[model samples]
Target: MKKKDLLKLPSVSEVLLEINDNKYHNDKYIKYIIKDEIAAFRSQAKQGSLQLDRNQIIQSILLKITKLSTASIKPVINATGIILHTGLGRAPVGKKIISKVSKRLSGYVNLELNLETGKRGQRQEHISALISSITGAEDAMVVNNNAAAVLLSLNELAEGKDVIVSRGQLVEIGGSFRIPDMITKSGCKLVEVGTTNRTHISDYEKAISSNTGLILWVHTSNYIISGFTKQVKIDELVELGRKKRIPVMSDLGCGEILDLSNKGIPTNMIVHDVIKSGSSITTFSGDKLLGGPQCGIIAGKRSLIKRIKVNPIARTVRSDKWTISLLEETLRSLRMDSINDNLTLSLMVTTRKELEKRANKLLSVIPTKLRSNHNISIQETFVEAGSGTLPGATFDSIAFKISSKKYTPAKLSDKFRNAQNPVVGYIKGNNYYIDFKSIISSQEKLLLSSIVEVLG
Candidate 1:
């Protein structure tokens, strides 16, 4: 910890001179990184853990700079098979949809222009009609995400009033976003009715008063309570709202625009059905079950939508041109009954037989050298429609069960994850598994190459 030892550390100018790469030419930024590194070295020296090698310190600084310069949001293969995995981006837009959107948006075409009138127009106009047609709502609007949609609805309709919600339906979604918190943020009071396991219509009736701004019915999309659980339905709430002359809002967390029961997926209330149930306003996520880009869709009575659009917060959370364009095409695909062209739905509806074929194909292509060195076999597994869309429902899937005496499961998984194109898999018991359910066909070659590179 002596001053003489600290002076051995390289100066900022010395380190900058060593960094010859032109891409790291931001001298001010590089100097800041160098100063931060030097401070850390001094701290380590005081703690008696400093490595005195000047070359090593400079290399460490270079590595930090390189890491900071690289983009952290690059795409990685989702090998864990959790379709709609939140960490991997909940919904995957189809290539055709992306191609069509790129053609229109790569340049510009009527983002907010009334070409005929030769004046400025609203961006929501691009997708509002499409959403109205698909969902049967009198009118609709798009926002940045579902949370914002719910926030905007509550703020516009129930600010300074009580928003009644069932205790059972007051669930927390990803990143600790809770229903009660959202209501409070929207300038409304959260009124909890009935018990966590049971909420009767009478509970709602007793809670309503002159101060009740809106009756909120939240869908427990992420979790379920069964056996002795009772909750009010949308239609029942709608009837009560009509009798009481109060607006009822339903937050269908993962909104379904199509009936997926035929695809072996569980059925939920499609947006049209929710609108038909007579709710005043309904908010749902565009990314989850809708198989669209990340956005929140608010569809309901035309009058209510009009008020929501006028709220200043609406502009703050509004969807941009790119989101509108992508969502419009996604809705069109749904309208045309082209499920195969929707990546999220296609992946959800991928048959067990198809997954088996994909698994076998991958196994067949593994080099003989890798096969001899590792125990690679196909095994049956299950993956969920993640992001809280279908709780308690798991689809049948197949995975490559890889085991090796030379490498532990953790080591094998790490190696795959750090490859040129990272492959993410799960380790269970003593083996590492890569489920083929979520891996698209186009990624098969890359997956094969990663496996060979790691095991060879």
Candidate 2:
């Protein structure tokens, strides 16, 4: 084809005729491709440095065509059974809440307006009371993410002031976001105290000078210093702050407000109790253990919270309509007395017997040939309530281990990852470990089909 001829931005009808003449099967996609081609051609009307329009159009169309033909948002069997699988968008929102969001998104409602009086109402009011009721905090506010919450808090209180923190507590979470960097960005002077493994209250006390504005304690949620580790208690710091007339602020990273000391969670990890620890302000995430939308929630003395709210960055880092709506509903769920049954994390932490039933259903449906090719076994597996919530611990669960002759672990994983809905499972010891903790009963059939297609 000549340059100008190729540049003739094919119309829908012309494209259809060419495909028909060539006996191409995909006429349905030509309409969208032709539209993209035309848009590309017109946008390059300026004297171009390179032939940009002609080259990228076909490639863009082909990519879009592939995506359009493929299953876009189909559900996958979560045999990996990670309750809070961060990669899989964590907890699935209830159908009721999802429908509410759909209805709200379709048009505008009083997202910013109070329907009762026609006056401008606080957006946080949608969920604040519910969160307050559950946590017993005087006041609370939310931002886009936990990092933003920490940034906003540091900027508000300790800007250009010495913020005392434990050396071990200066953590680097996912994506290289370090605590010291956050403190620097917020204009706070870093005052590191004690050793990484052990820090006494006296170390914190010694660090406090007239410049000490806030004491920051960050949760080492992802790491554990098991042997010979001691740190000042949150309550102790709260007491110290009271005595010294200084404010203690801690970042309850991976914020779970539940009293998990007895719920089989690790020791002394309660957000509310820590909040009540005389800390003037407690900042945590709305996502993570909370199983809500990604948000940084700060709840504490109304006066300090008010200052943080008025800071200019609050407007910049505020939650959007969808996040606010989902978070509000999720907080409401937590406040209800009957919320235990509905909790997503709690549900994923089901016993092995629950998963065994689903596994047996899958086993019955799978073809005999594939089953014979692999040794299937149910072994005790542990699952993390991921999203950085529960670290160094796993819930007791069972998984289906399939080791095959025809396909290797990598090949099987690749097949599932590229399948219609994309299944993600772990491969350990040359076998695929499909944890029952993550899988639901309804997904058993699809899991069987996927296995059959890969190994059938």
Candidate 3:
């Protein structure tokens, strides 16, 4: 506690040697971590902000080292009912997709090689046919994400020209990405054509000029604009583009390939439907509705796709083999008509009865006494498809509400997050909720253990 005692703390060399005995592979990294912890403790001692006995110095150093060891990116359970939670890594992939992608990671196997001709091949060729077949497009290519795809399309088609877009569709979503900003960055002039809530086809007709290079229709998937709203349809825009000889493009931000209308969840323009609507090009995110890795898919007519593919920006925003492999596997599963498929998005859109069953099963795993500790109950809840998809739409789900007498909602949330595999949930007022919409059946046991550990 005294200055003299602080001066007698373990030397850096001694602490480094002690840590070296723990079998740390990198001596330099361990030595740096040990020295940094010691400096902080010494600073605190000088300022009288804290006191540490000489005997506790080694233990403190060990704790700091242990904390650093576990500070890597590890997987956590998602109980937040947000199927596409951006902060928690948008969509979850199955083990089969993981294994298939893992195989492509080690060494190499025809990543850019054509097996039939035994020559160098294009990387996009691997998934191009699958995407075209699934989306009914003449051709398709991929970029790193939807943003990149938009940038590439705009730069390649409308550079130094006019891009007509609706004022309502000039949206800014997560990560500060705005349509006007992207248009400016693409070296194109943005010609706003419609009002915020309404844009008639005549607006586009008036905006068209000799400089009009592209017509962009952005699907406001992140938020809803309703009540006296009128936007030009893709078919109408495509008809106009056909007459004017200008390319029509649609940005289906969270485009889905499957039809979920039967599940009571209304979906917007599907990728294939947009392609069939005669848009010259359509772009969407692979991670959101497709339930694949983070990538951007651009599908449309063969001529437009060919032009976009040869653009120099396409090479910079292209997807790597890891994304390509997982995407290929995901598309294959979607194409199959099997009933026992394990798609992540499909599971998130499961029926209310199925979610209630999963919730009850999770509750049954927790012992009766532990359940009573927090006064847990199975409550009907609603959750959104997070990360800017289906903004105002919420799906029916089951949530286990816990009201702890010993701890408030905040304290209980902290406890759940401190688990080995952290559990994320939602809290409203004084109650903490773990929704069953995003929690898979295999995670029920782990969720039960985390709940019991927190409340018991």
In model 2, the runs with Cα more than 4 Å from the true position are: 1-64, 68-74, 260-268, 335-337, 340-343
Question: Clash pairs of candidate 2?
Answer: 81-438
Question: Per-residue lDDT tens digits of candidate 2, residues 1-456?
Answer: 245544644455644443333433365555766677566655554333225453355555555555665445667666676777767776655556667677877888677899999999888777767777667788888899989999999999989999999998999988799999999999999999999999999999999999998999888877877789899988999999999888888888877766554445554366677777767888887767776777889888889988998899999999988999888777756632344533464554456777677677777777776778877667788778776666787777888888877788898888888776567889988898888787755566677767776676
Clashes of 1: 0
Candidate 1 RMSD computed on C-alpha atoms after optimal superposition onto the true structure:
2.1
In order of TM-score, best first, we have 3, 1, 2
TM-score of each: 0.94, 0.85, 0.94
Q: Model 3 Cα displacement at 93 (Å)?
A: 0.5
Task: For residue 172, give model 3's deviation from the true position in Å.
Answer: 1.0
TM-score computed on alpha carbons, candidate 2: 0.85
With candidate 1 superimposed using the best TM-score fit, by how many Å does residue 438's alpha carbon deviate from the native?
Answer: 0.9
In order, the Cα lDDT scores of the candidates are 0.90, 0.76, 0.86
Higher-TM-score candidate among 2 and 3?
A: 3
Q: Candidate 1 lDDT, tens digit per residue, 191-255?
A: 99999999999999999999999999999998989999899899999999999999999999999
The candidate that wins on TM-score is 3
